[model samples]
Target: MIATRKLRRARVLIAGCGDVGLRCVPLLAHRAAAPRVIALSSQPARAAELRAAGTTPLIGNLDERRSLRRLAGLASTVLHLAPPQKNGDDDSRTRALIAALSAQRRSVARGATSAVARQRAWRGWFRATFKSSMRAGVKMHAKAIKRPSIVPDRVPGTAARPRQIRLIYASTSGVYGDCGGAWIDETRPVRPDNARAKRRVSAERQLRGATQRGLLSASIVRIPGIYAGNRLPLARLQKGTPALAPAEDVYTNHIHADDLAAILVLAIRRARPQRVVHASDDSDLRMGDYFDLVADAFGLPRAPRVSREQAETQLEPMMLSFMRESRRLQNTRLRDEMRYALRYPSIHDFLRDFLRDFRSEANAQFTITSVPVESPAE
Candidate 1:
């Protein structure tokens, strides 16, 4: 029974346990008093993979509310990396997740109420017994319980309670829309211009609302372009995809995959309630120049440059959408607030190391699968 209780009291739960969520598993698993890591996966096939990564696989889909019911009281720390459904402006997935986690509130309230009621009854009995002793001409001295029936379980610096689970949300920087290559901070209000970014905005709003209502203690990490040793633009470079000309190119931010995983772990320790952070590196590179950097590092030919109007015709609408949005993100909170030291502080740092390994074929097992843009939240 003790073992069963320990297993049920898993402390960390990861939703959308894909590449990034999988990356977070070991970081939590190898701690001093390591917490049991539970990862939610829609795919049954990935259960073995999740277990191999030192996490307990919980088969649950964010889209299906019934499957998520068991999530109540299952974890105190939640890493919500699951994304919105591909089709709508609203994030139904996050809504379902919130509903499932919020289910804990009623049961916890009932428990607290029962405890308070018992304490009150015990106090009344003690006071009456003392009065009877005094009337019987016998001296008795017993101290009254202090501060009973009013215990506070609030989170530090916020009104959130222990009944509410703590969560870290992986949000996208694209929620800011087209910034005209301007330098922006977390303080900048979001003005999403497309359906994809609009969904992200809706998710953020829902999380913030949940926090306000004391359902969960949420921290939003507004991530920019994420690159790794294997997640480079090698395919796009090899495919000869046209990049925008220097005059038309826009600024983009980046963070290495390893660095991002570390940041997510740190947020659990250092992030405040309802805080927003940008998980971006320090480099400021234009879209064309970034492609050129990858091409040059990999010893590949640079693709031809095209005007924005020409790109409209040449590139797909998805690619064009990424091309339209441009902003330089400042990760001040990620540094000062989270106190995180990035492994790859800039893309150049990762590229320099990666190029050496590629030239030597140090890890011949390394493979690159094509993904179009630098994945932010999704």
Candidate 2:
């Protein structure tokens, strides 16, 4: 059985409380210890919902040093889920947070005149340190940041933690490039053939660097196509988005967002090593076949097909590239190491559940529409 003691009721700091982070909240909330979840988002509406869900949601910029200090002080483990920054802004934010936390520690370590005075002094120092960090963070994250080739230098005046905090950085499978129908596992060498894939490879290196330096207990989770409920591709087809079958036999993987979140939480609880974990359901369904399944689920027509030559010419460069890659991602590590089993293991299961919910919602809408109008007659 998966041990829950380490994570139960543990204070958690979640940055970028968007779709994934929000989904993780309810799962963590239901744990035995019922953790004191602290969510940080720049959006007010999102922060409000987090608050409603019994989590302490802070609405502020993550780039601010003060916010980082306050958050670091409150939680031992931090989940960084900010959008992928293409200009190294993410690195700056990480640097700032570490620096601010380091400063707070130094201030605390400085000798205090008296026990009571020291307590007061420490509190005052924390407030001032947080304020300064927040100011710096705001400037650093003001724009879209790109991933750098090498890990950036640590911020000055910040001390490294005796034992670094744990972090899980969400990544993408696009880093694998076109595997050409081969099976890929963690041990497979990365051969990124495109600009986007190259960038992801570089970003993964930076994450590994943090681990090597003993600055962070970091791991990378490479997620494939993720879908759930209304977010599934079938829903898009039902809503009349054009579904076309690619001419090439490109194989891809997918996982439910809920499952992905669960795996992450489980990994954290297990303190599973600083390593890479693929968050795919282990499905190697072809793109064309997958589309056919979606169509069947939604009772829509089979997607129109195009010749290989036509597909190459008609599709966008990015879309065409995706259809050309054919790789079966191995999930044996997740199964054996993490001992994690997917909740939705195949496209069939995903479509079945997704369609059931879709039909129920559609039926309710139809019933509301068909309700008889009460006449105001006599």
Candidate 3:
């Protein structure tokens, strides 16, 4: 279990509690102040794990207004790791939460009866306030929530007090979208040519706007490919999946999931809002080199290489396009500004460490399962 300091203790809410969220849960729960930790996930099974870990788990839709409002009231800090919504409107959920907070602030400003009465009324009106605020937020984004499958209907109440909150939105380095082998940093100009990259760029801007508007102390961490125990790409390679080899020219960056999580917690403690950080290891290896490492780790056959022309002809259009660009990410900002360091600083280091553990586990399981069964005595 990771220990936490008293200073870092604050009511923290983790939205979109997937693998990453679950990994962070123990860290938050171990705080010295024992800050109230709330986790929300649409999947009951996912929430159940958090509940077992002594967290208050709520099954709620990230896209629904009321769910976000309830979440905002309980948490002084929010971490967003949910998948982007369909269409171009990825900020809808965050906007809804902000609107709910604004309404609560307004209610407080208007002196809604007595403080005790207001608190009681806010508690009672939470569900309704969430619905209205969400609608208003969707409108601001020029999106009709009704068309989406995840959007919820309005529920009829007063907003709660708008408490101070900090937001850490996980983003992707794919925003750079292959910088043609050029080294890039937080200061690098983003020229996102692909649709996914373009959307990520837009999302980053929206997050910055929230910071500017004082909605929350916000920061963005543009992460690269993340791998860890169960989620590692090695497992897929071990299963005999053919690794795609695009042009050897397209370089890729990667970070261990543990390192990424640690950086997130570090950023929270540092409180450097409106900052953009790249969460990547020091090495930038080619895509083929990455797959080769995976193949070696799993004792699998080496991936066949193809000429650029053949690759373009045989691979999917999207895959070919992805292979066309190469970018090297520099994490100087994370090191100098955030004063952070990666535990797994190179792909080779990460692969070696992971494979060692994996092989040990495999050996142990084999030994356990290979024990000879005793013949039944007649």
Candidate 4:
């Protein structure tokens, strides 16, 4: 009975409940008639935090299909925030998830059909046999309640009206690979240069394939560099790392973490089915310019600029990999399809607001000291 009751209420399943997923929980939970929210967490320690965030924590790993069985036919909507498994070119986890949802959808269709047919037959018999008697009883109850009451409405969907599950996948903008400072849109062909970007491409392909198969209405939000006050590259800047010269540098993109979270929610609620949109802010600064801006804002010396040849030897390979990609994402589709206006429209705006509080805290720490006060009447 409890399971039946749970099934009747709308539920949203978050397959990956990390930083952004945690943010999305409250967005759904605080609605007027909120749906039940569930989050899958690999670590049992986070169960309490997930619960506190108003989500029922499902302890499961995306890699283990057996662990995910509880999620089948469970939610009307799913937010697949999990990334592709490490050490793989293809995403087997996504494949498993799609299969599970497909199986459950089919099962629900059959069950709903059977249940609806049985309900109609039972209703017909009850009306024919107990019409007069039920009328009198209903009249008496109406008098007491001051209004006539009929049987409660049936559960929302039937076989004829199967629920359509929707998915919003977060992808990486690296799929466009080294655009040579051109403006790339969703229609741009993906040219992933590394294994990491390849893996993201594979995940996007799987979701797109699922959409084509009519298993789910899916939207892909290809994100670029995500930054916020807490997630900035302050540590790298403080390390005195050198950036590529402007002539050799790549044009980079950025979206504040909060704006990315908002876009994810919007994609789930408003994005067109099978659509791909860039979730980037209006900042179109070069790699060195971005570092310089942040350094200037934080009152740190700007990183020295090095030629491409010198940077290869001086910078770490991971940093070099980022410097190789150059593209400004066109966010027309995001605005048109998702109807989203980014809260942090650019890096300068976000940093200015963040540094205001950051500088205050820094100043307070520098001036304040803890000292023991003597007890007057010990």
The digit string of per-residue lDDT tens for model 1 on 71-174 reads: 98788899999888988899999999999987877555443434464455456657877899899998877864344445444312222334458899999999
Task: Summing lDDT over every window of 10 consecutive residues in candidate 4, give the lowest-scoring window.
Answer: 369-378
Candidate 2 local lDDT, 89-131, one digit each (tens)? 2345445544543454444334432345455554565556666
- Best lDDT goes to which candidate? 1
Residue 156, model 3: lDDT of 22
**Candidate 3, lDDT over the whole model:** 0.65
lDDT of 4 by residue, 1-378 (tens): 988876677888888887778778878876666789999888999999999988999998878888888877778788888877777688787888888777766665454444455466445545554566575674433233321143322323433435778888888888888989999899999998887778888888888888887678889888888776656566667778888887888888888778888888778778888888898888878988988887888777888899999999997776788888889999998888778988889988888777687777855432221111100000
Q: Over 4 Å off in model 4, which ranges?
A: 1-8, 108-162, 359-378
RMSD of each: 5.2, 14.9, 14.4, 11.1
Clashes of each: 0, 16, 1, 0
- In model 2, the runs with Cα more than 4 Å from the true position are 1-9, 62-69, 86-163, 234-247, 356-378
Off by over 4 Å in 1: 1-10, 110-163, 361-363
Q: TM-score of each candidate? A: 0.86, 0.71, 0.74, 0.80
Residue 189 alpha-carbon offset, candidate 4, angstroms: 1.1
Cα deviation in Å at residue 284, candidate 4? 1.0
- Give the number of the best model, judged by TM-score: 1
Q: What value does the lDDT take at residue 139 in candidate 2?
A: 38
Rank list by lDDT: 1, 4, 3, 2
